[model samples]
Every structure is written in structure tokens, then in C-alpha cells.
Target chain A: MTEATHSAPAPSPSGFRLDRSSWAWVGVAPFLLFAVLFLIAPTFFLIIGAFQDADGHFTFRNISNLFQPSIIASYWISIQISAASAITGAIIGFFMAYAVVLGGLPRWLRPTLMTFSGVASNFAGLPLAFAFLATLGRTGLVTVFLVKWFDFNPYAHGFNLLSFWGLTITYLYFQIPLMVLILTPALDGLKKEWREASSILGASPWQYWRYVALPILWPSLLGTTLLLFANSFGAIATAYGLTGSSLNIVTILLYAQIRGDVLHDQNLGYALALGMILITGLSNGGYIWLRARSERWLR
Target chain B: MKTSKIGPWIAFTLGALYFIIPLIATFEFSLRLKRGEYSFEAYRIVLGDPRFQATFGYSTLLALATIVIGVLLVVPTAYWIQLRLPKLRPVVEFITLLPLVIPAIVLVFGYLKMYNSSSLLPLTSSPWSTNLLLTFGYVTLALPYMYRAVDTGLRAIDVRTLTEAAESLGAKWPTILFKVILPNVRSALLSGAFLTFAIVIGEFTMAALLDRPAFGPYLQLIGANRAYEPSALAIIAFFVTWACMGLIQVFGRGARGASPETR
Candidate 1:
């Protein structure tokens, strides 16, 4: 492709010299059109519907509906679940990343971990829901084990697979892998020399990591954590698949409200959409902030 | 060089077990068939089922169509934004990323509402249009991968000189795109195509919602009724997804970390 082109950065016809030609936009035209029509338009429709009533009259009802207590409870529940999963995912990922990269595991384990990360990370939605069900559902192996050993049942013990805790556990399947994938690069970024130099200077292992390594890793760690938060926050499939339409989590609620054939509650559905958008948006914003911070640190 | 600490090793073993046990149990349970004896009967059941055969066919065709159209649409769009409209990259990129925020279930629901045949534009219902919508949905998914692939390919090579050189020789835009640019980014295209295929094959919500007989819906149907066979089907689906992704990785030759172009 570059056979005919000059290797050096050549000035353009304009007085202000741009390096390469600026005709790449031609290729982007078709996709851009698709984006506007499919994505942008639908999003606009969703957003606009929030401020409008079932009768199509524009109103502030949807915005006000967001601050209601039940709505508030759903938000709080989602926040807590997302928070717990993100923290656990980050912590476990940190250990796994450290061990896999630095531990005594065989060299072949790296690609296995990578490939498993792909399968496990993409292993959400329905099959994972059923996988958990087969293991922990009422007729599940774990439930049966619990019964035989301790005379326990999940319903009596309150180990609700149809609840927030179950959702979080299922979410971790993907979250941990995603965190590892994002953080492995950061883990690799921890130069061996930095650790060696610190250790050689008579610093203890804990002290070296605490003072030096932690400082270096802070940005990538933060950025990756925020990315994890966004990833988990935007996920609807896991929650939906695990509990069906029973749970009132934000995404599931939004899905139900939108599909409200009986109530015909268009405005309320939009309000729920707003909740999802804001939740995901905040995490995305945090991701961008940390990413920029990490770039600056790297530079 | 240092010997591994016992503590972290134990923790990882436990964690890895937690991750692996379900897959193993799922496999073991699937192998249990006909009075719960260990057998390949479940596999025979799932593979031999008529619905499975039909759904698998539709799913493959849907995935292939999406990949081809997705690559064609995304590569050009990514190429356009990266090479031609650099000033509007953010705007274009933002639009492309809408699929991530707007979940497929949500969008498909919206599409069902918006693009119904009897409304707005006059169009007839056909497998072609149904495939188009299905492809369109999958393309949005494949979009980010497609975008990233083409964008990376663009970044790896000098675009201006190639285009100018082609133009100087009186080569048209399409020729430059197909002959020079597309071939350069073929690996990227295939990688995106593979991802599109993987996601589309297992996608249940859209097919279920659209009432289209794709593989995802087939799995759902089997899952609700036949237990062991569904587990077998799950394994097959997993391997299919794995093989599809492996093919993409092989073809892409290090195409990971690239952006997917979305609609």
C-alpha cells in the first residue's frame, strides 16, 4: 500500500503542511450515515420520549419520576452491585495478573489464561445464566450439596440467585477477565528494574511496592477500575438472564417499562432510560478521566 | 526466578477452580443422558434435531452476511474519518460508539417499533430485508471491531501517498479502496468479521424478539425443554464461538486491541 508514497512527512498543497492526505472521510461516509440513522436517531428517540407523555405531549414528568424513592432504591441497588463487583473484580484481577506475569506458573499458562479470558469474558448473557442455574438453581448441584450436608435449602437460607448478590457473582465471571485483560498491560508496564533497583537499595518487598510500584501503577489501576465499572454498569444481559424480568434492577426495569404493553407507559420507560444513560455515562466519564490521567503519567 | 509463594498459589488455584468448575460440570451433566447414564446420546440428540439444523444454518448465513456488509460499511467509514475527515473524528467516533451505550435489546425493540413495514417508508417483507435488519444489528455490534480493525490498518500505513499515487495514475476512488486499501486491511476486516460472527451466532434476544429462527432462539428452545442436550448444545456453541474467534485471530495476525466500527 505504501509502495508509491513518500516515506517522509511531506507538506500538502495548503500553506499549512499536513502530513498525509485527508481523504479518509470518504470511507467513513457509509458508516457515519448508518450511525446517524440507526444509533443516533434511536437514541434521540429514546431521550425525547423521556420528556414526553403517553399522549405525546412534552412534559417534565419523566425527569421528576427519576427522583422518586422506588427509583432511588433501584439506583442505590445498582450502584452497590456495580461498586462491589468492580472492587472485587479489580482486586482479584490484580492478584491474577501479578501471579500470571510474575509467579512460577508455566509459560504456556499465559495464552491459556488469555484464551479463557476471552471465552469467560464473552460467556455472559443466557448460557452463563443457565450455567449458574444448573449449579446453584433450586435443583442445582450446589443447592443439593447444601441440602445433603447441612440440611439447608437456598430459600430457607436466603441464598437468592434471583437477587443482587447472585447477579454480582455472575457478573464477576466477565468482570474479572475484563479487568485482567485491561490490567495485564499495566502489570507488564511495571518494569522489573524498578522492583530490582528498589530491592537492591535495601527496600523491603512491601515497601518497594507501596512507595514505588503503587505510585507507578496508580493511573492504569484507576483507569482500568473505572473501565471495569463502566463495563459492569452497562451490562444488562447478566442481570436479565439470571433473574428474568423479576428483579427491579435499573436495566431490567427499563427493559420492562419499554415493553410495557399493558401500562402503555412510554414516558416512564424514557425516564428509566435516562437512569441507565446517566449511570453508564458517569462511569464512562470516569474512564476517560483516568485514561487521560494515565496518558499524562506515561508521557 | 524466585520460588512461588504458597499463599497466592492457593488463592489462584481456588479462583481458577471456581471459574472452571461450572464449565466442567456443565460438560459432565451434558454427558449424562437417558436415565442419567454417561453417554454421547445428548450430543446425538442436539446435533440431530431438526430445529438445531435449521437454526444453525440461518445463524451461519446471518453471521456471514453481517460480516461482509459490516466490513464493507465500517472499513470505508473508518477510513473516511481517519483519512478524510480527521476534524470530525470525535463526532464520528461518538456516533459509532452508540451501540455500546444503547444495548441491542433496546435498539432492536426500537427498530421493531420504527422500521415496521406498514409505516413510513413503503417496503415489503422479505428474507432480504429481514436479513438486512439482522445484519444491521450485527453490524452495529461488529462496528466497533470493524472500525478498530480498519482504523489500525489505516494508522499502520500512509493513506495520502497511496491515494495520491493512485489518483496520479488516474485510478478512481473505488479502485484505490478495493485494490490498494482493502487488501492492505484484509486482516483487519476478517478479524472484525469473526467477532461479528461470534456475537451474532449466539445472539438470542434479537432473534427471540424478532421471532426469527436463528441459533440463539434454537438454543433457548432446547434449553427450556431438553436439559442434557441443551448442555451439549452449549458446549457446541462455545466451541463454535471459540473456533470462530480462533479463525479471526489466525487471519487477523495480531488484530486484537483494534476498534470495532459500529452503526
Candidate 2:
């Protein structure tokens, strides 16, 4: 650490050049302390506690208990919802972004959509749940109108607004906008020169999208989809507000376990949170990796 | 060209419908407080309720506290890193981004365990301490936004040159930070502050678990029991979010700020 002392000979504050270097480290101490206490320590505590029995003895009992049928079902259902919403959001958001940026439309439309997308994406949680309920619930405007006007009963057709499909659709309320907000910039990165070059090379529009556009856009598209997956994976408020605890997604299940230890084991709750962190962490980590890869090409 | 226009319009229209219909439905439902006619009775009822005022007031204060703490913690740290510790940028960024990856529920769950009554710090030992804990949790949740915003703001201005100039003029560290650096990044800080306010207001899981009388829990409570009022509350919540987003847009655009929408 003192190797650089000769380079900073002008520093005489503490009569030791090494102390100047340490001042730089000291400047960040408060931030490090805050992060560790509130953020890192809490997470580390959970991970450590997950491996301990109720009496603080080290054990793998909680990890093994995670394989139970109910817990497995919760994880499965949560994954299903996340995948459904993310893929659906990505496809629609991509096309919407593409249309606004490349498709022949009013120039004002892109900014308008982008701004609305910003609001809509942030407009999640309880009120978002209510908005969907009002739109799709049994006596909701659309539902009632469909029943009264067209004699089409969605419920009789086995379409409930509180089921897996309903939750996925509800999740899309924010997911699609989030997709639009993210994909627009990525779409903007598509150079017009690339298209021109493709056309000059006798490539059809289909061929351009297939060989050039999709290749450049794939990393961003996949990364954003992964982000959306993590976004919904850990989302508890929207699902909780929409279906209450009845949805049985991992987040809500974890919420129940935290609230009352419904899992019948205190250690298992830590494991549940650990599993959640792992899933979201992996997806977000994947997103960052893919984003870095895409950014390299774009640059 | 005409055919291309058709496809784009169709996509835009479909996307708009998907977004707009629910809002329309929600507004219409909120007006259903009158049995035989449209009325703002639900709005009146919700606004008239004491619980609404109390929780909303509690959350607003909490949001303000979070913003002050978040800005104070993020700005100096971000500025310091930019000027003195560029090598640690990626590590700082990773730590800031941790909250996004680790769900709020998980973080709060950890908080419940690590700071509960019997823990070392025992943050949950009292209601006031729990509120402080929730404030810190909000700070954690807002860390990514706050740090990125201030860092970008700092980047926009020349941190090294400004600090060097201030030092040459015999300005102290506090004076340099407060008068020179902070004023330059005021817009970015406002942008971050607005976003943090928006997040803290509608936050549910953390506040609910922490047993605070925040707007999120109150909204959830009303949604569970009532019908039209929930819709009304939803619209109000939506408006608050919209207003915050709008403020960010105006301020962000003015500041020429860099904020990661996806993250």
C-alpha cells in the first residue's frame, strides 16, 4: 500500500503520504457502513440463518424441506407467471417500440408512447390491481358489456379473472409498458445505415430483420425479457392486491410465511427468501451480462 | 408506404388499448358510488376518511425523510467516488443495484429477522424505531435510482476540476461540496428525489410488514373491504405516480440527466 508513497511526496498533511491514500478510503466509510448494515448484513443474515436450525445449529433441513410438493408448486406457478408475462410483454413491447421508431407514423407518437410507458410501468401495485379488476372482474365494464351486449359470458367460458391467466394478463399491465420503455432505446440504437446497406445488398425487409436487425437486437431483447422475469418474479404487491394471498405465487407464499410462518418451520422461511434472491439474482445477473455483450456490439 | 403505416398504427392502437382500457374501467368503477347515477361519492368518502388523511400524511412525511436521507447519502458518496475512487465505481454500482435484484419482500424479511426485538440492533423494538427501519429500507430501495441520478449529474459536471478549483481558492470540503458541487447537480437530485417520493408513496410490502400506517397499506385495506373507493383510491394513487413521473421528465430533460429506466 505504501508503494505509491514516493509518487505523492507533496502530501504532508499527516506527514505520511500513506495517510492521504487512506483518506480516500475513509471518505467512503459511511456509505459502506450504511450499505452493510441495512442491505448486505440483512441479506447475509438470512442466508446464514437459512442453514441453521431453530436452535442455531447448522443444518440443511430447510434446504431439503424446499422440495416439498406445496413449495415446489408455488415455485412452479411463480415461474410460469413470470415467463408468461415476460415473453408476452417483450413481444408486444418490442413491436410497439419498433412501430414507433421505424414504422411510418406521426413523429409525435413516439414521445407520447414513451412518456405514457414511463408512467404505466411505475403504475404497479395495489391500484394497478384495482384497475384490472375494474376492467375484467365479473361485473367489470368490459365483462358486463360483453355479457349484456354480446351474450358472451367469459366466466361461463371458464375464464376467471383471478386465475393464472388472469394474473398473467394483470402482470402484463405494467410489463408491456416496461418493455416499451426499455426497448425504445434499444430500437433507437438500430442504425438507418444498416437498413440502407441491407437494401443496397439486395436484401428483402424480411432478410434484413432476420440477418441484421434481429442479430443486433437479440441481446437487448433477451436481457430486457430476463429483467422483466425478475421484476415479476419478486413482485408481491400487484399479485397480492389483485388476488390477495389466494394466488399462491412464490412472493405471496413467502409473504404468508413471513407474516405467520405458514410453512411450519422458521428456518424454512429464510430458505424461501434465499430461493427468491437466488432466482432474481440469477436473472438480473444474466440481464447485466447480456446488456454488456450487446453494448459492446452497439459501441 | 401505406401498408407499412397500417401495421404500425395497428400495433400502436392495440398497445394503447391494452393500457388505456384498464384506466378507463377503473375511473368508471370509481364513479359507481351512486347506485343509479354517476357520482364522486367514493372520492368524497375516501378523502373524507380520517385514516386516509393520517396514512397519507404519514407516507408523505416518510417520503420526505427518505428523500433527504437518500440524497444526503447518495450525492456525497457518488461525488466522492467519481472524484477520488473511480476504481470502485463498478462495486458501488453493484451494491446499489442489489436492492433491485433482491426483492423488497426478501430485504424486509431479512430486516425482520436481523433487527427484530432480540437482535443486536433491535430496530423493531419500538414503533418509532421500526419507522426508522422502514425509512432505511426505503433508502435501500431508492439507492439505485438516487446513486445513478447523482452520479450522472456529477459526471455531467467536471468533478475533479471543480474540486481542484475549490481547493486552490481555499474552500473547505464542506463548502466545496455544498455550494459548488451540489448546486450544479440540483436538477439531477430533484429528479432522483421525485422518483424516490413516487416509490415510497405507493410502496406496500415493506411498510405493511413493518406495521406502519403508510398509504400503501391503507390503500390495500380499503381495496379489500370496499369497491368503488378502491377504484377512486387507485386513480388518486395513479395520479400521484403520474405527477411524480411528469416532474422527473421535466426536471430530467432540463437537467439532461441520465437515469436507467430498465434498472
Model 2, runs deviating above 4 Å: A1-18, B1-3, B257-263
Cα displacement (Å) at residue A174, model 1? 1.2
lDDT per residue, candidate 1, A1-299, as tens digits? Answer: 22112222232333213533444333445666677666666667777877898888989987887787877787788788888888888888888877787776767777778777866777766677767766776766677778999898876877888888888887888888888787777777777788789888998888988998788788778767777776776666557666766777666665565556423566776667666776677777777667677665453
| Top DockQ hit | 2
lDDT of model 1 at position B225: 65
State the DockQ of every prediction.
0.33, 0.59
Give the per-residue lDDT digits (tens) of candidate 2, residues A239-274: 998898887999999999888989889899999889
Model 2 TM-score (2 dp): 0.95
TM-scores vs. true structure, each candidate: 0.87, 0.95
State candidate 1's TM-score: 0.87
Q: For each candidate, how many residue pairs have backbone atoms clashing (under 3 Å)?
A: 24, 0
Which candidate has the top score in TM-score?
2
TM-score of chain A of each: 0.85, 0.93
Candidate 2 per-residue lDDT, tens place, B1-263, comes to: 32358888899999899889888999999999889999999999999999999999999999999999898788878877887678888989999999999999999999999998987899999999999999999999999989988887887888889877876786666777789988988888888998899899989999999999999999899989998899999899999989998998887776654433212
